[model samples]
Target: MAEFESPIVMPKLITFLSSLLQRAAESNDINQSHQSQKISVFHGLSRPSISIQSYLERIFKYASCSPSCYIVAYVYLDRFTQRQPALPINSFNVHRLLITSVMIAAKFMDDLYYNNACYAQVGGISTTEMNFLEVDFLFGLGFNLNVTPTTFYKYCSYLERGMMMLQPQINMSESSLYMGISSKLHLSFNEDESSQSHHQQQQLAV
Candidate 1:
């Protein structure tokens, strides 16, 4: 079995995936003309009600696949983007793409996984559509699903570094907010704020 990622990393993955889906939604909203044409061709529907973060957390809780599967799915998403730059991730298609990539990753990386129907239910789609997505996605990827450990860890390393980079920005943002509040309350700024911010940053860094 593939190893589960550290608890710290899983949330980072979740955040990253959710952001990608949101960006796709934003891109689709901004480019209405392209979206209409693409939707007509693919029979796409309006965006789903569920948030990407909630959907991913549901899959993580129920799918029972290792964190490695999610990592691989990330790789697949990247590869799909590279291979089909014209067909970018968007609101109309992001949900299907997310489901398809994770299912493929589970099948490729895990010994046992649920079938199309099960995954479809989890993804809130019909089995027929799931099957269609699986086949189409496989062809689009040229069936290159294999991922060596070295490549996998490289991705993990990149994600870890990204998490590290994100922490300071979050801390600074929060610190700035705290400072603004403290100033309104007639509290002193520099020393106390700096120490409190540093402490909070340390907690998140871990």
Candidate 2:
């Protein structure tokens, strides 16, 4: 079982993640790539007004999952996009994708965690819709949820690099410690994926 890293102690990681996602959401919003790419269930009719950073902080404050779950969730989203290149993370669908990915990551990483209805409430979506997303996410990823140690470190390095892009002066070696990846990859993905995210497969991880 994966040990949980409480949210209270992970404000830095949360902020770093929020920054990266904020950039992606804003850039994707301007481009609106769905016209050229494949659209999936995650494309909302209207983009939610809340900023991606605020929404992510809300999830961090409320969902109470471990910090590493955020990283693991990123990995899941990246894999999902790799397999389903059509639906990248745009503003239209980032929140739903985020909540579902975090919730599923929580299920796989934490021995004790929230149920679907509770997660649905936190995610600001109906339980029915959350349930639908869960199944579709699993299918979209083809149940390839397990992450090897190598893959886990790869993602941690990727995230650190992304953070470095936003903060160029930061040293890469120190950035790893700054992002708090100095420790082991705290993850265990037994459950299948459940979420939304996109871009070209190459841009998926942000």
TM-score of each: 0.71, 0.75
State each candidate's clash count: 0, 6
Report the Cα lDDT for residue 142, model 2. Answer: 86
lDDT of 1: 0.63
lDDT of 2 at 27: 70
Residue range 56-108, candidate 2, lDDT tens digits: 88888788876667877877777776777667678888888888889888887
Q: What's the lDDT for residue 204 in model 2?
A: 54
What's model 2's lDDT at 117?
A: 93
Expressed as tens digits, the lDDT of each residue in 45-117 for candidate 1 is: 6777888788888788877775667767877776665566566666677778888899988887667789899
Clashes (candidate 2): 6
Weakest lDDT window of 10 consecutive positions for candidate 2: 192-201
For candidate 1, which ten residues in a row score worst on lDDT? 178-187
Give the C-alpha miss distance for residue 78 in model 2, angstroms.
Answer: 0.8
Model 2, global lDDT:
0.68
